[model samples]
Target chain A: MKKSDIIKLLILIIAVSLNVKTMKSMHANQAEINPDRAKISGKPVASFHKFWADVKWMMFIQHMGSIDLTTESNSKDLYQEAKDILDLDPGFYKVYELSALMLSAKTPDLAIDLLKRGQETHQNKNDWRLYSMAGNIRHQETFFNKKVNKREKLREAIGFYRLALKKPGVMPVLEKTYIKTRAQEAHEANNDVPLVIAELLEWDKYVNTKMAGSEYGMEGEGGDMFLSLEENTKKDILSLIQRVKREHQNNLAGKKTSKAMLASLFKGIHTCNSCYNEYGAGHKFCTDCSKPVKVYGICPNSQCRKTHSNGKFCEHCGTNVKPKKKKK
Target chain B: MDETFAIASSLWKRLLGVRVVYFLTICAVSLIAITNMYDILMIGESRALMVDTGMMLTTIAAMLTVISLAFDIPKELQSGIASVLLAKPLGRTHYLMGKLIGVSWVGIFITSLISIGFVVIYSMSHGAPPAGLVKALFLIVISVIPMASIVLFFSSFLNEAVAATISTVFIWVGYSLASLNGVTLFDLSLFSMGAEAFYNYEIPPSYLLKGVVSALLTAISIVCVTSFIFNKRDLQ
Candidate 1:
């Protein structure tokens, strides 16, 4: 045979061998029907049964895993199996996102790990939607952690809000706005009016200087600052401030209303400050009076309905009161 | 035109074919719709209902392609009627095109009617079809073009039974695998890895791959028809 024919024969052989190898590799990658694995894991080996079970477990995890972690929910097993199912079929990207979201409520660290795994496995691919979900989980974590520190809580809330805003997918602005307003309320409910007013002024200043050239214009430019305030119960804050100011003015006027309102305002402020110490942060004002109140001692005055701010005198009525000792 | 219509009517009468094909198509589609209903009830979740319907349509389309092409060509050849048919005003290409069109129309019509029935049942049980169902159905129909072309190509080359059955299964597997690859899966097991590599790395985008596959099948079908026209001597 000629040199050309020999080369052609060799090339054909190589081509056929490669094709056979490719075909073998294709079939070899499928999950084997391992009875032991199935028995231990309690997962079905059959494709249809496995697919059905995986989906069922995915739904179960979603519902149960979302409950408070402090509650003794039977979600641990569901979450574990859901992870296994994901490991079993990594192609099911929806399962990964759902599992992460669910797991975050119980074990935020595990949720973050799962999300990282998902990102690593399915990056810059069809499953990029999972990244946005992972970001949301991170945002929830930051929100939870913010409740730990009083002074840093607002800053942390802002960090979380900014992180969520930076994510690519279009999150509903209303939802974020609700979260931000709640954070602001929680902050105000903890601190005194001067602090809140200071924070608002600082935010206004930051917007003017830092966000001037950007899309987020000055306070009134895009109504960014005013929009945040719109959802807030301005009447509650305004009334509290007006009461405090009237008391201060009455202190100069030498009137009894000035003395009474000053004592009430001081008690209300003390209650809020004490509550922040107890509850950490994110406490709401009273549903009845819209005043920042705390659960401490009982009402001291016979006629007065409101509780005292851990004092011997009635802050509202100036009636000398007794501190009730605990029975235990 | 009258003569052509008369001949077409006569051909239909001579074949006694319409009823069997119609019955088979209905049975195929009904079986699919029933299975789909079972699937929906069993799953008990709101999924894209069109997915199951599309799968059934795919199977029906494949069956129609194989059965129609395999029988039509060999039956023409075996009866020594090819010469008589070619002797008429119609060319071999036109005859082949007409057969394909008629068979495809019958297949599509039956499948579509069954699909409508399935949709009605689904709506009654659930609600109106979701946003993407129509688009998905269009994709399934587009997929059948390649399936039919492949069957026609195989019919020209091979004997009826082997050609029809093999090509039917082959087309079903090929299309299913091709579409499955579009979805990402992360099982690093040998089987999944192989599938992923084949789908993600080896194959181009599904639309492009389907276009190429369909074009190739059409080209082969045309070649087969041309061969039949040139090679087969008249057995008068």
Candidate 2:
């Protein structure tokens, strides 16, 4: 045989020989290391949780292994996993973020518990994200939950938001005006009129959507009370939502033929005589023209001009006519 | 009958004659099996990485099988092996199918051995995986065909190395689609689906069916088109 062909043969033989050796080595190692075999020899693999010291590593491996896509409430594996992660090292805050968000959609209480534990454990760290998250949770639960006192939850949420603001570099103004008004002195110093109507309407939608379900069942003591509050709240909020939506359209049209456009869409649009722009039904100012808007038609006697009624009953002399109820 | 048998036998001989591919397969499976044995030390920790890594190793062995097909078929035609087969009573279509069948046997054998190694090692850590997980792996095995058919389809017109490269590229294209927002084509991603289902995510039946069925339909279409085209070609 030529030298090259002879060498090729040698290489092939050597490679096959090495492959066999490697397989043998692998088998020997498996015999020594296989969990089943080890169990027979009095060395069962230690249970999963015993390695709490390696919680970070454990969580990392567990998450790496599976991110359950199915949104099943029964799968509390993520919660247990998150708790373990926090228990071993309270600093794994990322776990709380993911775990809390996923858990909250199903179980708000556990979600709050996780965030609370995280907050207490990492208090020294002064993490604003934690405080912001806690506040948002309480705020959402105020609407989502009815078993709790709504006013107290709202107050707690406000407190959390305040704490978050005091933690340095917080911009409370970006979120909502109420927090901003409470937070900044300069906000009050300005001549800016607060957009209270718009804010109230949004809160109305928030309460309506959550309470539309049996948030806190109607069977208990405060359940009926909560339902009454929600009913009245919704009634007030719905009227506000309609009013704001109208004013919003009128402002966009500005002072130019806004009433004509508004009259085409809605029948009872309150137009500004000063600027031909429309306002909400119960407004006090021609918001566009800066003139007095609420020409109160609130009088019971027709002969008094001292209490001016726009066009309806006289505030000083005519009988007040309540709006007729629409048949459903 | 004698001529067809002779043709298939010749094709098998040429594939078996390539000592290097055989050695590579053995080496790949051994490496995966051994590394998995070592991961057993992690004990009660997630046995997922073992399955995930093994799935990757199986893909490597499948790739080697595919790359060999890229060169082997064209090299056979260039070296007058095709003429010898065509000289028989065997038709052009049978000759090509015989070659494909030979390639499939090699691919299935090597991939199966590698998959077994993965199962063995994973079993050592956490006993037998669920039947559904095994089913996903089997689907991965089936997904390999659509890719191999692509290489075969390309080999009908392109150079051997180029055919293999394009086939590998096609597999990667199916894979990268996973990063895009919605339909990640998990079932079509073959072994990746197994790795994800076993080690990463809970794959639902609807998703599995959609992916695997689409991939199988694709392979059947490609194989048919390539065979018909090859049958019509006039060899130089």
Winner by TM-score: 1
Can you write out model 1's per-residue Cα lDDT over A11-31, one digit (the tens) per residue? Answer: 545544543443343333222
After superposition, the stretches of candidate 2 with alpha carbons farther than 4 Å from their true spots are A1-328, B1-46, B177-187, B190-192, B199-217
For model 1, the stretches where C-alpha displacement exceeds 4 angstroms are A1-97, A105-136, A139-229, A233-328, B1-47, B51-59, B62-66, B75-95, B118-139, B142-145, B173-236
Model 2 pairs in collision = A65-B199, A298-A315, A299-A314, A299-A315, A300-A317, A300-A318, A301-A317, A301-A318, A302-A317, A302-A318
Classified by CAPRI criteria, candidate 2 counts as incorrect
- For candidate 2, the per-residue lDDT at A54 reads 37
Model 2 Cα shift for residue A78 (angstroms): 21
Q: Candidate 1 at residue B36, lDDT?
A: 47
Clashes of 1: 12
TM-score of chain B of each: 0.63, 0.76
lDDT of 1 by residue, B1-236 (tens): 44334444444443345577556656655654554454434343323223343344444543564366677676676776756776778655455554454445544555566556555655655577543343334434444444555565566556678877876665545533422332111111111111122123222233333333333344334434444543443444
True contacts kept of each: 0.03, 0.00
Local distance difference test values of all predictions, in order: 0.45, 0.52
